[model samples]
Target: MKILPEISRTLSEYLLIPGLTTEDCTPDTVDLGTALVRHRIGEESGVRIATPLVSAIMQAVSSPELAVALAQVGGLAFIHQNQPVEEQAADVRAVKRHKAGFRTIEVTVGPDTPLGEVARQLSATEQGVAVVTRSGDTEGAFLGIISLDDFHLERHGAHESAGSRMRGRAGLVTAPVTASLSEANELIWEHHLDVLPVLDGDRVASLVLKRDYQAHKTYHRASVDGEKRLRVGAGINSRDFKDRVPALVEAGADVLCLDSSDGYSVYQAKTLEFVRETYGDAVSVGAGNVVDGRAFRYLADAGAAFVKVGIGGGAICTTRAQKGIGRGQASALLDVVEARDAYARETGVHVPLCCDGGLLNDSHMAMALAMGADFIMLGRYFARLDESPSPKVQIDGQWYKEYWGEGSQRAQNAARYGQGGRMVFEEGVDGFVPYAGSLYDNVERTRAKLTSTMISCGSTNLRDFHRDAVLVPVSAESFKQTGAEVQLRRPTADH
Candidate 1:
C-alpha cells in the first residue's frame, strides 16, 4: 500500500501572515460577498450571498426562524430535513413568506376579544405585538395594536376587552402602503411610535417595528429574492429527491442541498443527474462532505452548484471515531479548492467551495476563507443563537442551547447517513452549546471580526483575500503561545 508523504493539516496548526495593509484597506471597505452557485469564469453567479456565512443542515441549527434571520444578515440557512416532507416544505414557505423590515401580523384579536385571549396570542407571537382588527383577521379593518407594554396581566382585568386597552387608531401612527421604509421610519420617529402599521385603505397589511427598522439599517445587505422575500434553502436527501425536490421548489426554496454524511457515491450521482435533467439550471443544488480532490472533481462534474469540504469534523460528528474514514478539515478544503480552481480553468465554470464544520472560533473562519473557501457552513455557531430551532435551558446557572448532529441517534436521520431505511449506528452526538443572544447581534460582531481579519490581510474582498492572504504552519508551542498566558483574573464576589 502506498501512503502520501505530506501530512494532513488542521486550521489551528497554521497562522495567517499579515500582508501589506494599504491605506484603503479597512473593515468598513471589506466586502464579504461571495457566490453561492456555479457560474462561468467571467460571468456572475445566479445565486450569491452578500456574506460568506451559511447555517448547517441540522435540526438543532437551521429552522424557518433561523433561515429568515440569516437571510436578513446576508447569509443563507438550509432548513433541516429531519422532519416530514410536508413540514419541511411548510418551513420553506414560512421563510419565503417573510418580508424583511415588515412583519406579518400573525396574532390578531377582535375589538371585543378579552385581554386574557390577547395576552395568549401575544405570547404565541415572536414579536409580542398583536393587532386589534374588526373581525380578528389579519386582513380585517385596521383598529389598533396591543403590545406587551399596553397592559399588565396583574393590573388589567381578564374580562377587559383589547379595544379598551389598545391605543386607538385615531392617535396611532400609521403609514401608507406606498410609503418607503425611510418615510415610514420618519413617521415612526416623528410620532415616537413603537409600531407603525402600514395600511392599505383601512386594512392592516403589515406592521413595521422600530427594532426591525434599525435591524434593516444595520444589515442593509440582506439577501432577498426578486420579490423581496428573504432567500432560504432546503436540505434534501438522495433517497427521497424525487418527492422532496418538487415540493421544496413549489414551496419557494431559493436553493437545495443534498445533505449526506458521505456524498461521493452512485446514489448522489444519480440524484444529481435527476435534478439536472428535471430542473435544468433553474434549481441550484449543492452537494458534499467530501475530503479530497477526486471527490470534489466528481461532484463538480456531476453538476454540483457548490461543493462542501470537510468530513467527520463537525462538533457533534463521530464518523472518524466510529469509522476511520475522514480527512483533516483544512487539508480537505485545500485539496478541494485546488481541484475547484483546476476544474474552473478547464471548463470555464467556477464552482464555489464551502468549508463545512471543524471551525471553532472566528479566527478559524478567517483562516478558512484565506485558504480559499468561498464560504463557511456553521452548525455549532448558529445552533447557539436564539433563532435556532432548539430551546435554551439553564445549566449550572449558565444558559445552553441544545445541539445534535444529523447522524446522532436523537436525530435518527438515516437518509443523510445512507445506511438504508434506518440508522444502523450513530455517527454523531447530542450536546449543548453556550446560549448566545439574538442572531443579529452575534452575526454583526462576527462580521466585524471577519472584516478586520480581511483588512489585516490587506484585502477588501473575499476574492482578494483568497489571492493575497498567506498562511504559515505553526508548531505546537507557537500555537499555544498565541493564546493569553496570564489569565488569572477571577470574578469579584458580589456582596
Candidate 2:
C-alpha cells in the first residue's frame, strides 16, 4: 500500500494554463458552449468538445430524472448500474424518451386549460411562447399559441381571457415536419411569428420556439442524438454487460460506460470488445476508473471510446487510505491526457480522456478542463441535487441528502455482491450532503464559473482553453494565500 501523496501531487495544488485577456473578450459571449454529445468525441478530434459534465456511478446519486436534466444542459449522466437490469434500463429509457429531438414541447397546455393554469405553466419556463394543444398532449393537434405577456394582464380572470382559445390561433402559423432548422427559422422570420408549431399532417409534432433559434444560432448544438431525441447514457458493470448492455441499448441509451471502481480487468476488456463489435459505432462506451498512461492505453486498445481516470479521489472513496491503490487526481489526469495524445499521434484515433473524481468545486473543474480532460465526472455534487435519488433527511433544521459510494456495504448489498461474486471489501462510504435546490441551479452555476474561468484564461472555446491554457505552478502556501481567511470564532458550549 502506497499513499498517493508519496506517488504524486494532489489537485489541491495544481493549475491550468493562464492567458492574456483583453477587454473585448467577455465571459458572457466567450462561446464556452459544448458540442451536443451523441457518440464519444476524442480530445484531439476537431469536433471534440465532449459535454462538460457527467455524474459518477452512484445509484443513489444519479437518477433517471437527473440523467434527463443533465442531458438538457449539455451534459451526460451515467445512470448507475447498481440496480436490477430492468430498473437500470428503465432509467436509461426515461432519459432517452424524455424530450423529442428537434421538438420543443417544454411549455404546453390543454386547450380547455384556463388562463390561470396556462399562465402558471408559462411562468415556469424561460421560453417566450406557451403552446396550447388537445389534452395538453405535446404531439396533439395545435389549438393556439400564447405569449409570456398574456399572463401579465391584471384584469379580473385575465387568465380566462385565453378562453377556449388564445389570440394567436387567428394568426397561427406552423412549419412542416420536414422543415429543417433553417426552414423553421425562415418561417418564424417570414411570418413575424414568435412561435412556429411543426406539423406532421395537422398534428403538432414539435414547436420551433423563437428563443431557441435566437440563442443557438451560432453553435446550433442541442443535446440531440441521431434520432433527434435528447442524448442519454447509462453505466454497466463488466460482469453484467451482456445482459445490461442490450437492455440499455434497446432503451435508447446513446452510450454505455463501464461502471467499476477499477476498469482494467480482463472482464472489462472482453465487455468493451463485445459492445464495440456488436453495436459497432452505433454506441460509444467509456471504459475506466483507472489511473495513469498504461491503463489509458489498455482501455483504448480494448475499444473504449474514452477512458475515465481517477482512483480514490472521490469524496466518499476510501480506496487510497484502506487499500492504498489510488493516485492523486492531478497526476492521474495528466498521465491519461498524455496517453490519449500519444495514442492519437500513433493511431490517428484520439480517445477522449475523462476526469472521474476529485472535483470538489468549479475551480477543480476548470483545472481539469484546461489540463485537457474532455469532460468531468461528479458524484457527491449531483447527489445533493433535488433530482437525484438521494433521500433527503432533516438535520438541525436543515435538509441534507444521503450519498454513498458503490463500494459501500449498503450499495454492495443492494447490488447483491458477495452472494456469488466478489468479497465484501468496502472502498467508499455513505454520508450526508448539504441540500442543493435543483440540478439546474447547481449545474448552471458550475457552467457559469467555468465560463468565467475560460474568459480569464483568454480562451474562446474549450479547445482553445485546452490548447493554450497555461499552468502556473504554485506552492501550498501560495495557493492558501489567495483564499486565506482569518475567522473569529465565538464558542458556545455546555457549562
Give me the candidate number with maximum TM-score: 1
Compose the digit string of candidate 2's lDDT tens values, residues 1-495.
644454475676777655888785685566655532223335423222234887877877778778777766677778888778999887776666544325556677776677776767666654556777666777666777776665565563644645444655556777788888788888888988666788788567777666656445422334666555667778887677889889998988777788776777788899988987897877778888888888888888888877888988999888788777888898888888888888878887768777888888889989988888878889988999898987899999999999988878778743323345554577778889999898878877887888788888888787788888888756878876777787867777952
Clashes (N, CA, C under 3 Å) per candidate: 0, 7
Consecutive 10-residue window with the lowest summed lDDT within model 2? 37-46
After superposition, the stretches of candidate 1 with alpha carbons farther than 4 Å from their true spots are 108-122, 127-178, 187-205, 391-399, 435-438, 480-487, 491-495
lDDT of each: 0.88, 0.74
lDDT of 1 by residue, 1-495 (tens): 877777888888789999889999976788999999999999989889988999999999898889988998999999988789999999998888777767667788999999988888777656578888899888789888887798987899887899989988988878888888789888888988888999999898887788777677776888988756789998988877899999999999998998987888778888899999999999999998799999999999999999999989989999999998788888888888899999988999999999998899999999999999999999999999999989899999999999988888889887677688698999999989999899989989999999998888899999999998899988998956667678687878972
Q: TM-score for every candidate vs. truth?
A: 0.84, 0.74
RMSD of 1: 3.8
> Alpha-carbon error at 42 in model 1, in Å?
3.5
Q: What is the lDDT of residue 62 in candidate 1?
A: 91
